[model samples]
Target: MDESRPTPATPPAVLADHAERMEKLLDRLLSPQTLCDEIARPERLRAAMAHGLLGGGKRLRPFLVEQSAALFHANTDAVLRVGAALECVHCYSLIHDDLPAMDDDDLRRGRPTVHRAFDEATAILAGDALLTLAFDIVSSDETDLPPTRKLALVAGLSRAAGIGGMVGGQMRDLEAEKTDRPLAIRDIEMLQSMKTGALLRYACEAGAIAAGASGDERARLRRFGEIVGLSFQLADDLLDLTSDTATTGKATGKDAAANKATLPSLHGIDWTTARLRDLVVEATDLLDPFGSKADILVQTARYIAFRDR
Candidate 1:
C-alpha cells in the first residue's frame, strides 16, 4: 500500500520524505507521454499499465536503491531512474500476483486489482509491458550511466527478476503448497529469499553499480541487501498473521486460506517479531563503517520491521 505519512510515533523522517519524492516521480514516469505516447499507443493498455503502476504502494524498493546510491554520492538523476526501474518490476509483479491464477485476490492497494478493474488478458499484457519498460528505462541513454554500468544493471536485474531469483522462488512456493511435507525454517528462508529477497537484493546492488562503488563497498551493500530481504520477509509474514485486510490495503489471512507455508506459520508472531528486531540491529550495525551517513538506512530498516502494514 501507499506509505502512510510518518507520525511522531514512527518518526521515519527519511523514509517519509523519500516515499513522497518517489511517488511524484513515478506519476510522471507512468504517464502515457512518458510511456511512448502515440496515436497507436492503445489507450486501454496504457490505462491498465497506469492503474497498475500509479496505484498505492510503499515504493520502498526504489527508496532503497536511491538511498544506497546516496551512500556513494552518486548522481541523483541516475539513482532515481534506477529506483524507478525497480519499481516498475515490483508493480508488474503485483499485477500478475493478484491475478486469478496467482493469489486470486480482488483487492490490491485498496482498490480492485488490475484484472478485476480491467480483464485478465489486459492485466497480463500490462504486466508484460511494464516489465519490458523497466529494462528499457534502465538502459536508456537518458540514464546517463556508462555502458559498463548499464550492462551491469541490465544483467543483474535480469537475473534477479528471472529464473535464478524471483521466478525460481515463486515456483518453489507453488511446489510447497502442493506437497504434504511441512516446510522447515530453512525451506521457508530459502523460499522467501528468492521469492521476495531477489529484487530487494538487486535494488542495493543497482545502487552500487550506479556509483561505481568498490568491490569491497559493493560486497558490503550486497550483504546489507540480503539482510534487508530477510528482514522484510519476516515483517511481512508477521503482518499476514496480525493485520486485517483493510489495514494492509490488500488481502490478509490468505496464506492460511491457500495453505501457503510462511515463516510466521512455523514461528509464532512473538518469535518472528523478536527476530525482526534483532535483524534491525544487525542491519544497522552492518553500516557502522559509514556511521552517520548510514542513519537514513538504519531508520529505514527500523521502519520496515515495525510498520503496521
Candidate 2:
C-alpha cells in the first residue's frame, strides 16, 4: 500500500547552516580509499566492500554524530572522523543484514545487495572488513581527538555493535522467527532498541563524549538518542509497509513475507502511526536543554516519522 508523500520537515535552521561544514568534514574523513590495493586477493575483496559502502545511504547516523558534536562546540574537522567511522559500522551491518543466511535481500540502497552484486562469500568478508575497519578508523592517530576521548568513543562503539547490542538483538529476532511466540509491545520496543537503536545511540553519545560534553549534556543527549532511536526504527517499520521498492531501493513488503515482528504487525497502522508521532515529540522535547543547538536534531526526529522514503 502506497502512502501519501510525507512532509519535508527540514532540520532546525541552526543545523541547516552547518550543512556545508558537515559535508566538508565528511568529505575529508571518508576521502581515503578503503581498499589497500597493495595485495591482489585483498583487492577483489575491497571491490566488493566499496560496492556496498560507497552506495548513497541517507547518512543519518553520521548526521547525528556531526550534530551532536557541534553541541559541544567541537571543531568540525576533528569530530567528522567520528561520523565517518560510524558510517563504516553502519555499512557493515547492512552488508550482513542483506546476506543470504540473514535477510536474503537482493537489493540495498537502490542497488543490488553485496551478495547479489558480488558473491555470497565476498559479501560476508566485505562486512567483516568494514566492521573491523570501523574500529581501526576510530582508534587511529589521524582521528584528531584527545587520546582519552578517542578511547571512550572506541569502547562505546564496541559495546554498541558487539554481543551486548546489535548482535544480541539479531539473535533475539532470529529466534523469534521460528517460534510460535508472540511479543508484547514493550518487548518489541526492546528488540528494536537493541537491534537498531544501539548504534544510533552510540553515534549521538559518542559524538558528545568525543567533544568533552558535560555530564548533564551527556545525560540529555542519551535521552535524545533513545527517543530518536526509537523513532528511527518505527519510521523504518512504517516505510516497509507504505514505501515502494522504487523509492526505498529495496523490495517492499519483505517484513510481511518474512513474518518479521514490527510495530505495524503488533499494532494496526493507525496505532503505530500515533506511536511514531509520540516518539518524535518526545525526542524533540529531549533537545530543549541544548537550546538552539539542537534544532536540527529535533527537526530531524520529526522528519524521520513523517518521511515516506
Candidate 3:
C-alpha cells in the first residue's frame, strides 16, 4: 500500500451522514413554498406529492450521483441538484409502481403508498408531477451548471426514465407475467438493466458529464454503475424471498406471489449470493485507478449487495 493512499475503511456513519443530508435537501426541494408562486401551488396536489416524495429511503441514487461527481471534482451544489432531480424521478417510479393497476402494492418505505394514502388519481398525478419536476429542477437556474452540462444531464435522465429504459423494462416485466413462458436469462438481464440499471448507470455517468470527464473515465464509472445495479436488484430479490415486510418496510415475497421470474427464484439463493459478491468485486476493481478516492464507492457497492433491507 502506498503511504499516501487514504485508509480503505468507510464507516456506516459516512453513509448515514450522506442520507441525512439528502433527506434535508429533498424536504426543502419538495416543500410547497419552494415549488411555485402561492397562487399556482395547489394544496391537495402538493400534499399528495409530499406524501410520496418525502417518504424515507436510503437515497442511494442521489448518493451515487454526489459521490461519483466528487471523483471528478465537480461543483458540489450543482451535483446535489442533479442528485435531487434523479431522486424525484426515483420517487415517481415508486409511486406509480405501487398503484393498483401496476404492482398493486399498498405499502412503501413503511407507510401507506401514495395511492392508499391519498387516491389513485391523486397518486397518478403526483407521480407525473414529480417526473416532470425532475426535468425542471435540472433545467432551472437553481442547479447552477452550464447550459451544455444541464442539457446533457437532461438528455441522460430522459433516456434513463423514458420508454426505452425504465418504462420499457417495466412493460417487459408486465408482459412476462402475462405469458406462461419463463424469461431467458439474457432477457431477464436486459430487462433488469433497463428497468433498474439505467438510472444507476446514468447516476455515475452524470457525475462524469457534470465534471466534463474524459470519455474513458465516464465509461469506467458507467460500468461500475452497471455492476452495482445488478447487485442491487439481486440483493432486493434475495431480501424479498428471505426477509419479511417488517424488516424490509414493504411487501415481501411479492415476486414469488406474483410468480415473477427473478434470478434468485430461478437460480436459487446460493447462486444469487455468490453473484452479488462477484459483482461487488468487479465494481470495486473498476474504481481501483482512482485510489482511495474510490473507497466510499467500494463501500457503497458492498452495502448495496449485502444490505439487510
- Assess each prediction's global lDDT (C-alpha) against the native: 0.84, 0.77, 0.86
Best model number under lDDT: 3
lDDT string, candidate 1, 14-79, tens digits: 666777888887788777777785876888988998899885677888888888888888848878
Question: Residue 46 in candidate 3 has what lDDT?
Answer: 87
Per-residue lDDT tens digits for candidate 3, residues 33-70, read: 89888888888888888898885777888889888988
Whole-model lDDT, model 3? 0.86
Tell me the lDDT of model 1 at 8: 15
Candidate 2 local lDDT, 48-117, one digit each (tens): 8777777475677777888888877885655777877787888888899889898788877668999998
Q: Which stretches of candidate 2 lie over 4 Å from their true place?
A: 1-41, 242-250
- Candidate structures ordered by lDDT, highest first: 3, 1, 2
- Tell me the lDDT of model 1 at 253: 86
Q: For every model in order, what is the number of clashing pairs? A: 2, 0, 0
**Alpha-carbon TM-score of each model against the true structure:** 0.91, 0.86, 0.92
